[model samples]
Target: MTDMIDLSVATRRMDRVLDGIGDEHLLAATPCTEATVGMLVDHVLGLTLAFTAAASKDFEGLTDTPPTLPTGELPGGWNDVATARLSALADAWRDPDAWAGTTRAGGIDLPGEIAGLVALDELVVHGWDLAVATRQPYACEPDEIAACLAFAGTVSDEQRTEGALFGPAVSVPGDAPALHRLLGLTGRDPSWAPPG
Candidate 1:
């Protein structure tokens, strides 16, 4: 069994990023090529709900379907809704049992431990995506970044292609910071910025 990771820090960081996003940034491009800023927020909301269900071993609608590109519209009071869901997601995974069984997320059945890591990775990476797209500062703790790095490092070319979990891994220097390496492994350039 893997060490249980506390998701509060990542969730709180994402909440801060969400707070900084304004209406003007909605149509802006994000690091995720398939999503605009608004779409990415929608995706986050969906994934937050889906992965929370996964933590509870609830294999229902959200867990059964793979996520598609989101429409670029946010629900009324989406920030409050998203924050609540993110909090629930963190709280769900704090239970040791949540990491002890098989769970389904994005229509793929995998071990609970792996699913937790995936959830963490989503929060960390997408948090960065939203931050950069909105011109906000982003910071994640070293331990959280390390955990995500370990998970991202394990993804192979075949898994990446088949699962569509990431783009082709970008090459970063061996001596780069852990976050940069994790970003590279997840197919993002550390220096990526919105188009001028």
Candidate 2:
């Protein structure tokens, strides 16, 4: 069995990003050019819910269809909603049983342990997306970046070329820090910033 990973790397960073956002920034563009702050938060919420179900081995809402961009109202308040859901996500995966046997994330079926790591990768990468888009400082433990980078390396060139999982990995300087390197691997520029 793989050792339990500290999910705080993802959760703490995400919480910081959420806290840094203001209502006026909701429609502002993020690192994901096609997505704005609100759009990105919506996406995070959907994934949080999907992964929460995966941890429990529940598949009631799981589907072969790709996830539609979340368009739900953020009525409960963005910080309150995202914060609560993200916490639940961490708690769900904390259970050893959540890392045992097979589970489904969206439509894909994979091992529970693998799913948990994937969840972490999503949190880290998307958390960065939120932070950089909003011009906030993002700090994650080096071990967290290393873990995501290792998993990202497992994605084949073909999968990236086909855009099946990600865009082609962007190049980064050899001397880049782990987070910068990890961002580049996901086709994101680490120095990206919103227009003033």
Candidate 3:
């Protein structure tokens, strides 16, 4: 499938996960990291903005660099962040030529397909992150998982070993599917325990 489709589907799934979150728990943290639910949500939104900025070749208004983890709280609630991110993505996607255009950020140069696919990976992994961080079940379709797996494969083993590109690796069940295996390879427990 094209990166655009992956990006669209991933964003929809992200919206579903964000919509399902309870307001009270939005700021709660998980055992895996100190990132509160709100922070995780914002981290995902931050990622969207960063990618959109790169795709559109606009780096003027971004407040900060997209960190691998949440450095602080989300400016508004998850709803606000979600809305902004969705709007930005919708706007960027509208100008396919622009989105498909090239640009640079922090000295890194990338094409549209690379940006979109990277965004897709983030959407999927961070969807898992939000779910895992919030003690919710992430019902990712098998195909989405497959897409993530394929993308993850592109990250050279050298990159994985460099540390933090994908979190610590977890063990996948021998009988699990490719997506589950891939998730395990990237540090998420497929059968992660819910928060107490």
Candidate 4:
């Protein structure tokens, strides 16, 4: 149940960040890259939902299935998707271990331990993304950052080459707070903003 607890706390933190933002700013694009505030939030929420879905269901073709963004009728937008995803995550958390089964990544079959680790990493990094999108300062708790750093260190060289998901290769200072410096290395400027 530790994994469930971790995910719950992480999701709550993100929820707090998102809930703090006014609707006007949810559409703002940060200075980072192509993703607007909505897209980035979608990316994070989408990933979380995928993980939760994997845990919940055993569809053999899931990886091949492209995810559709959640939306509503009549000019629906990011908020709709975010709200739906968050609700899904909450539902998933309620019975996390029920889906605590094997998963695959990079063609490597993963047991519950590896899958939980992956989920943990998601909670940490996406927490940072949420902060950047909302322009809210988040100081990663020491234990959580240390745990993520440990996982980051173990990421295979092949995985690192896949993309910016593991973020920049440079090492974050052991002393630096996990959330800020780690997000910085991952190309997310927590302070980033668009032109007014």
Candidate 5:
């Protein structure tokens, strides 16, 4: 069996990114072509809740529904809500049981271990997206990046279709940093920035 990963690093990085967002940055373009800063934050908020539920083996409601790009204004106090949920997500996964059972997230039933890796990938990648959109510095630990890279590498070509969770892998130098490689595998340009 694979060792369980610690989620604190990814969660803390996401929290710091959340702290840097301001009202003026809400409409800024993100590396994710389909979402602006506000929409992505909304998605983060939803995913935090869904994945936390998945960690607890609670498969109803949030876990059953796949996330969509939020089109409306963020909820009041969304920052606090997101931060709290992120912490909860990390905490929920610390239980050994979470990594041992079948769990569902984003409406797909998957192994608990795979679901945990998916949650980490979301936090690490979306943390970068939010940081870049808000013009904040982003740093991910090597272990977190490696874990996400491993998960991203498992995405099949068929899963890269339109509207899929990941897109076609972008080309990056073989010697590129692990974070860059991870981003490339997830179909993101590592050097992407908000439009001027």
Candidate 6:
């Protein structure tokens, strides 16, 4: 078995950001250039559900998740849906067995350990994306940041530079906060803000 990584803090951090989001900020820009706040939320929610299934090695009906959020008023019930799924994801992954053996996500096979890391990475990165886009407060503990940093190193430079999973990385000081380093490695500027 590999090292046991904890995701409780990352899930809590994302829950805080999701709860703070308002409808007005749904259209605001985020550090992820390809997606606005609403789209990113949808993506995170889809991923939460996807990885939850992955943790248990379940592959039924796993497929592409179009950037679809529930249709309704802006930001209508978004947080409730997202937080519940994220929490479920965290719970699903809590089984140590979930971190062993091969797992399926989106109909593709991946090591369960790798899939768990990806889940944590998604929460950390997109949680920050939502927080920044909405001007809400977010803080990640050192362990969460460290796991994401290690995940960043797993992505190919081409993918990151071509803006597939990430854009070209933004540089940050080594002495910066652990969360800032995690953001920078994921192609987000530590000091980025939406244009007023």
Name the top lDDT candidate.
1
Better of 2 and 3 by lDDT: 2
Each candidate: RMSD: 1.3, 1.9, 3.3, 4.4, 1.1, 2.7
lDDT of 2 by residue, 54-86 (tens): 988887875234567656356667688888888
- TM-score versus the correct structure, for each prediction: 0.97, 0.91, 0.78, 0.69, 0.96, 0.87
lDDT of each: 0.90, 0.80, 0.66, 0.57, 0.88, 0.78
Candidate with better lDDT, 2 vs 6? 2
Model 6: CA > 4 A from native: 63-76, 161-163
Please state the error at residue 90 of candidate 4 in Å: 4.6
Give the count of colliding residue pairs in each prediction.
Answer: 0, 0, 0, 0, 0, 0
Candidate 5: list runs displaced more than 4 Å.
Answer: none
Q: Residue by residue across 111-165, what tens digits does model 6's lDDT show?
A: 8888888788888888888898898888777777777788887777677863445
Q: List the residue pairs that clash in candidate 3.
A: none
Instruction: Please give, for residues 1-196, the per-residue lDDT of candidate 5 as tens digits.
Output: 4479989878988988998898999988999898889988988888888989999999769889877757738899988988899999999999988898799998899999999999999999889989988889988888888888888888898888545678788899999999999989998999898888
What is the per-residue lDDT of model 1 for residues 1-196, given as tens digits with 9 covering 90 to 100?
Answer: 8899999889999999999988899999988887899999998999999999999999868899988878978999999998999999999999999898799999999999999999999999999989998888888899999999989878888776523777789899999989889988888888999999
lDDT of 2 at 172: 96
Cα lDDT, model 1, residue 12: 90
Off by over 4 Å in 2: 62-65, 161-165
Deviation in Å, model 2, residue 105 alpha carbon: 0.5
Off by over 4 Å in 1: none
Q: Which regions in candidate 3 have their CA more than 4 angstroms from the true location?
A: 1-3, 31-34, 61-69, 98-101, 105-107, 161-163
Q: For model 5, what is the alpha-carbon lDDT of residue 93?
A: 90
Q: After superposition, how far is residue 6 of candidate 5 from its true place, in Å?
A: 1.3
Model 1 scores worst on lDDT over the 10 consecutive residues at: 158-167
- Candidate 2 pairs with clashing backbones: none
**Residue 137 in model 1: shift from native, Å?**
1.0
